[model samples]
Target: MKQTSFTEDQLTDALRALKADTSDERFRLLTSEPPKARIRPLLWYGVAASVAMLIVAASIWQSSWSIHPDTTPTATTATVDENLSQLVGQSIAAQTQAQQQRTLTNDIVSEHLSLVEP
Candidate 1:
């Protein structure tokens, strides 16, 4: 192999060029900027826990509203029922009166026909 030699001045100029290329302002700025903030695992866990708690609370509230226990009958309800029964009784009495009147008219007509035939 032939021996290759670099002169002292040539080696220094090459090193200077390499140093200048490596020290670019754009590369320095990119490296110097602070790193972006990252979300923590604990924060995600807390959010999940809060959502679960809210769901549980909502379910409990809904169930409590839906399941109603029977209470004592109110006076207003009793009075309404009483009025309804009275109206039904009045309707039945009116029907009975109408039926009796029809029966009386039929009897009178039959009696008149018998007298005329005899």
Candidate 2:
């Protein structure tokens, strides 16, 4: 009697048997379950959206203020002048004080140098 090679029908039957195994079914079921969501990317997208919204709102608010020419609420002229004078006076005082300090420092430095040389 001659030993026979497996035919196409026999191969198909074996493949079907393998697929019908309980372990294979469980593995397939487990693998086929929906993938879990990654929290990092989702959180990043949400943060990006919030940042984008804040930027848009800021731009819109800035635009609204700039769009209407009449919306520039006028400052009282007297108050503006007074504030300006005060700031200018403060600046002048600071400059004067700085000059005085520089003069004093120069005198001290010259005195020290003369004393060292003598």
Candidate maximizing lDDT: 2
Query: Residue 84 deviation, candidate 2, in Å?
Result: 0.4
Clashing pairs in 1: none
Clashes of each: 0, 0
Query: Model 1, range 20-89, lDDT digits (tens) per residue?
Result: 4445776887677454423466678889999999999999977765675453334366787998999999
lDDT of 1: 0.79
**Quick one: RMSD of model 1?**
13.6
The best candidate in terms of TM-score: 2
Q: Which pairs of residues clash in candidate 2, taking residues 3 or more apart in a chain or in different chains?
A: none
TM-score of each candidate structure, all chains considered together: 0.36, 0.39
Q: Go through the candidates in order and give each one's C-alpha lDDT.
A: 0.79, 0.83
Off by over 4 Å in 2: 1-74
Q: Model 1 reaches what TM-score against the true structure?
A: 0.36
What is the lDDT, from 0 to 100, of the residue 66 in candidate 1?
A: 61
